[model samples]
Target: MIFLRNILFYPAFYLGSVFFVLASVVSIPIGPAPLRWSVAAWSRFHRTCLRWLLGIKIEVEGQLSREPVFYAVRHESFFEAIDAPAMYDTPVTFAKHELSIIPGWGRAAKAYGMIFVERDQGAKALRKMVSAAREYSQEGRPLVIYPEGTRTPHGEAGKLQAGFAGLYKLIGLPVVPVAVNSGPMYHRFWKRPGTITYRIGETIPPGLPRAEIEARVIAAINALN
Candidate 1:
């Protein structure tokens, strides 16, 4: 049954994504609000597919802040990335610079307020990221970033990427670390039925020393492990 469902889901999900991407292209010129809404609708559609087709459900713990802040999330799978805008209202998410160049989807992501980072570009990239983050903060949008930089396998706790600490300090917003155990269930081609939980940890205020803040974020985001 699971195998059959997975087979059905792959085509439906991809085809639905293409439709959403095309819809985003038409909405892009209208501005960020429309683009963001279209993306959120896509995320919700994905959630529905996960629930009905795969028997996978999402359970979020703790409160999401009303004020704008930074969210450093565990990178377990692509599930969290697509689900983010649905989790937070019009969040400013970070994606690789390469993804931002991917024709139609890339242009829509830019219009929808995603920040692309070129890790190899060093200080210059950090400057651009900070500038964009500040602009989003002013607009009352939370910034979501994957601190580990890439997906890690289940049970593995990877080091936070180099740019995270710098971005945290430079952006100067309160940080919320979110721990998610979505890898074991959602990362595979043939997924299992289970609840994927987002365990939101306490918000760490900005301006602590680098070591202290980094330590706090690392511990918090890995809390479930």
Candidate 2:
């Protein structure tokens, strides 16, 4: 049944993606803000399709604070990336600059408040992230950053990256530690068929030093695993 579902699922998902690409392009001339919301809605629709296709249900926890709090989340699966847009009404993602290079995906990402960082230019990228995140916060939107910087395979915890502390310092907003566990279901290899949940936690106030903040975020995620 899982094999049959996977086969049926991907094609429908791809077709839906193409439609979203068209809707996004059509909305472009209309204006970016509207386009952004349209794309976000489209993404949510896409994830809903994925859930139905893969038979993967999601259970999200903790309140997504009404304020524009900075969310430091763990990276594990494609599910996480897709889940963010669906979960938040207004989400600004801090993704790698390379993602912006992809053809249709790149354009869609930029449309949605997705900021890219030049991997080679470490310091410059950090500064750019802070600036971009602050700009989003000023605009009254939440920023979603995968503190690990990249996706870690299956159950392994990816090494924590450096920018979260700086971003927290720059934004000066309370940090909401998001611990996601999609392992029992999604994986690069086994790809078990089941639901993947995103368990969001309460906001960790910013009084702690940079090191402590990093440790706290990691600990929060590890605890759930």
Candidate 3:
């Protein structure tokens, strides 16, 4: 049954994404608002497919903050990444430098106001990401980042990446640590039919010394694990 559902989902997800990708690409020439709208629509399309087609639903633990702030999220699957746009008002997401070079998608993401981090460039990349994030915050857009830097298996605790602490300190926004158990239901080729819950932890104030803030964030984001 799961295999049959996946067979239905892969085609719909990939082929549908192509249309949105083209829409996003075309909107680039028009301007930022249209480009962002195209991308957000694409994200919602993914969520709708996940829920109705695959029988996977998302449930929230705490109130999702609408105020422009930094959201430090758990990394379990690509589910949360897609869910960001569906849940926010055009969030500013942190993405890998590699994704920003992928032909049509790259051009669209760059113009859509994402902060690209060249993980290999070390400190230079951090500086660039911080600068971009600050600009987005000033525009009252919510910024989202996976503190562990990449996906991890469900129920496992992954170490917070160094860049996460750097971005949190430099972005200067109160961080809302979010824990999402997405792997159990959303990861793998054959996804399971279940609920992926996202727990929003208490907001941590900015400027609390590095050690204190990092510890708090780690604990909060790992609360579900």
Highest TM-score, which number? 1
* Superposed Cα RMSD, model 1: 0.9
Model 1 steric clash pairs: none
Top model number, lDDT: 1
Query: Model 2 compared with the native: what TM-score?
Result: 0.91
Candidate 3 has which clashing residue pairs, if any? none
Q: Cα deviation of 163 in candidate 2 (Å)?
A: 2.0
lDDT of each: 0.90, 0.76, 0.87
> Mind giving the per-residue lDDT tens digits that candidate 1 earns over 105-209?
998898888999888888998999999999999989999999999998878888888789899889999999999999988898898789999999999999888
TM-score of 3: 0.96
lDDT of 3 at 158: 85
RMSD of 2: 1.8
Superposed by TM-score, candidate 3 places the C-alpha of residue 203 at a distance from the truth, in angstroms, of: 0.7
Can you give the lDDT of residue 213 in candidate 1? 84
Q: Write candidate 3's Cα lDDT for 95-138 as tens digits.
A: 78888888798888888988888988988878888888888888
